[model samples]
Target: MSLDRHILSFLRALVSSRERKVATAGVVIGILYLLNWSQRKTSAKISLGHRSKKSNKGTVDLEFFKRIIELIKIVVPSWRSLEMFNLVLLSALLIARTLLSISISSVNGRIVKAIVTRDFNLFMKRIIQLAMFAIPASMVNSGLDYLNHKLAIQFRAKMAYYLNQKYLTGLIYYQMSNLDNRIANPDQRFTQDIDKWASCLSNLYSNITKPCLDIFLFSRKLSDLVGAEGPIFIIGWYFLSGIIIKFITPPFGLLTAQEQQNEGLYRACQSDLVNHSEEIAFYRGNDWEKRRINNTLDKIVKHINDILTKRFFMGTFDSMLVKYGATMTSYGVLGLPVFGPNREKYFARIGNDPSSITRDYIRNSSLLINLAKAIGRLVVSYKDLQSLAGYTTLIHEAKVVLEDLANGKYQRTMMEGAVYDQKSRGTYIIADYIKFENVPVVSPNGDLLIERLSFTIKPGMHTFIQGPNGCGKSSLFRILGELWPLFSGTVYKPPMEQLFYIPQRPYLPHGSLREQIIYPHSREQMEKLGYNDEYLENLMRIVRLEDIIEKRGGFEQVEDWNDTLSGGQKQKVAMCRLLYHKPKFAILDECTSAVSMDVEGSIYQHYKDNGITLITVSHRESLLKYHNHILKFDGEGGWNFYTILPDS
Candidate 1:
């Protein structure tokens, strides 16, 4: 065979075989690996630059602009449907206001003409026309403003609802807060920042649109009087002012975001002081706390001062340009006809009558000046425009962070942590067996806490999980609860509802005593479930919380339960909740630490009698009698599972 025929025969043979396909894939992967190795050997720095260059490219992409437009569309809904009737109504009012604005300008011009001509009849008629126009103009302006206020409230409510849905979905709040901590004071962003954004948006729509409309409408009138040169001069002035303002303006967006973060930090410090008042008071760290708070306050003040300083300079420049420069530019443009070739023609039209000619000149000059001033005011409000930009940028970034989290990018980061079971669904459920199959526990920062851990607790088999702090004891529970992602294995457990986790410090929401017991369920829900005072009284008696009902009046009374309940009392309430729900598996992390041994013992026995499997974590040797199995962590990635003997 010829060389070409031999090569063709080999190619056909390779295409025809399964093994050859596998070999082809291997070769391609090897080539890619070699290429990566070559790049690494040649220049690791340039290899790293590939990632950063991608990020830099994204910053200036159309997606960011599209996000902005989408956000604005969310804030200001279109008038396409019956649901947008309010916006349609608002638009009508805005159009009415625009018409009134034009009328007001025209009336001012007529009043000037009436004065210069000095016709008493014409002057009186013009005065009455001005009065009538002013009445409706003021009414329209106020009515439009009132309508805008309502629209703003509605818009804000809708936007807040959408953002709240995103922020609170799944474990989004927890992931954003604990796992990433990228968005600061998401609470304030939803409340204060959203409020500000709504207000800015309302004003921005009106301020930007109305000025542009007025400039266009008035410029036409000015053109009719002083030719196109008058409006051209004012437009040129605006362009010049925009250039100067853009150059002088600071990075207001970054500054505003920093200000918000500082505010959250300062507020957090104050909140900590309040929440841990007893701890701080016991330590007598009032002076230290004062200094810390003062330092935070100092930071807040410094940021505000920086903002104000920038604004001060901007204000000075804006005032000079708008107040004085606008007037001079207007007069300069108006005086062109008087000094130029048009002077002889302008006087000849009035037959050498200086008064009539001067009167016409005055009326036209005033009209031109007013037109210039309106446009100038828009240019001067550029600071507010910058501030609006700042708010939108922060909101957009937050939106991006939230979307990334929902897409599981943060949770699935290879070097950072575990790959979560993204397809897992359904609420908490406890099956007949709770099993871990070669599960490895890793921290959020990817440190191995436990490795290849396999264990199973069958029905009626109570287990005591023993480990030193930071040995992944509590973290193991987090993975089972699906709060933390699993590393390299599956944890076959019941759904969330059938598994209950009781932390050391129980969460006590402010409500009636009855609400505290059956919580995560409302009084209304309990009532619907056929629960009554007598039933609740029975549950409390079982948990030995009967005294609490007597001391706090009745179950109907509402108070700050966290403050009112003692540590032991809180734990007892949690037990009552546990017994009330009666889950198949309960993970108690030192939940009975505050309670007396007698009460703790009773609670454990009650769970055993109820056929609820217990996974308990505690330092006390007192809890051993209630369990059959022991899972001990060696403070390394090693764990041991053993049976608890009757004597030992």
Candidate 2:
């Protein structure tokens, strides 16, 4: 009976053990399965993120890096240039600052050791050394700031010059505004965007360069003091944290770009208001203008607020991980050399002196803290880098658009019922005489203003063009001046220098009365052409603007001429300018409308006497005697030419 009982107990015990083992194996497999599922979920999220990033317009990707490289070349230019030399000098200062930091850390340790050991003389000596070191340290810091600002200014100058060269060369500025619809508010881009980009780029170089050097030097020092494991472990922790932060970081680059764009729009709205304040007031459209400006302002504010909201949450996590968490980790690393398993080995070099141990602890602590801070700065710079990417995207887009315009490639939003054919382009020929052969007058929006208009005007053959509003009147001049692209046929006109255009609203620049007459030509240029202010005075007298010169000031006096001059006076100034240049052909588009009929006829007679051929667009019958030929538009893609009788 006893043997049977023993056999039953043994079998029951064996069964219980096997059940426990099976249950343990099931739990293990369940945990592994959960881990696999989590990993797949994370991988799917990352993949989705990459895909979404590619589609985002302002994403900082490989293309952004390439753009950065290209822009950097523009900012830096050459290794032998002044900018490069400044960079090299700045680098030297960075290295010097790092060396000074190391020395200060050592001196700090000695002072602490002296104080603990009650050695007043040694403490005094170390204190004197620290004070002496501070002078160069201060200079190095100041030098860094000065160099950074200087580099920023230099960078902006180079970039602005490059862009201006492209913008102002050959009718590009006009085409950019009138023909292409890609870039908005190029004025804002030149002034604000470029400045911000250059400043950010300059600061970014120092921010990144200094931190890297600090990390390398401090890491080396820490490794020597507390074994390679301490620096390696802390660095690895930061590396892991950086990766985690990257995943949590929002698309700051895209947000910054959007914010800048909205800011530009807001500025443009205000500029438009200022430029047309007189017209708006005349129409009592202040309320409407206010609403338009406020709407733009609201958009900018909303975007900026969104950025701030995101930054708030991001800043909290960043502070916790990079600041407080790093502090705790630093403490742990610092304690390892003193209280860890190999603590005795670390103490053997200086014996068991408390002062020596405290000194070593302070120095090691400084080194460790510096390493952590360096890593933290590197992590923080990711945000600045993203912001830089945003500016880079904007400036690069402007550059691409400018280059495209220079190459005669344009993209415009077509008007309804407009026709555009990419393969069809008009022909432009440079000749001494003006002629159009089957040339279709098309607006920038591809509107067919005149299907096939043909006309010719040789020098001394003054012609008058009469047409209804929007009946391809100014469109013809635009085509002739190359402001609007020709769709088909041929156009023969004089070189731009030999052709002058005078609109009803004369453009009086910000300069003296002399400049108003010889505009686009400086005093030196006027002198080079063997002309003087006296010559300009004579031309002004011909336009009846003689007394106005002394009334305002001398010829060298400067003012906002557009605002200061009356409507008639402004027109007279334009006529004076036309006489000054005395081009072969003048396209006067209602230029003398502001002047009285007497003065107007006299100005026309003056132009005719100067041997300048006039292509006038006007409705004034009184001036018909000045023109010998007439070209009339029927406002429906048709035109006719007739010779005016001598009596009429």
Which residue pairs of candidate 2 clash? none
How far out, in Å, is residue 184 in model 2?
Answer: 0.7
TM-score of 1: 0.81
TM-score of 2: 0.90
Model 2 lDDT at residue 292: 92
By lDDT, the best candidate is: 2
Per-residue accuracy of model 2 over 60-126 as CA lDDT, tens digit each: 6898889999988997889899999999999999989988888888888999999999999999999
Instruction: Go through the candidates in order and give the clash count of each.
Output: 7, 0
| Every model's TM-score | 0.81, 0.90
- Candidate 2 regions with alpha-carbon error over 4 angstroms: 1-58, 646-648
Worst 10 residues of 2 by lDDT: 36-45
* Model 1 misplacement above 4 A: 1-64, 76-78, 81-91, 109-125, 278-288, 334-370, 411-431, 550-553, 645-648
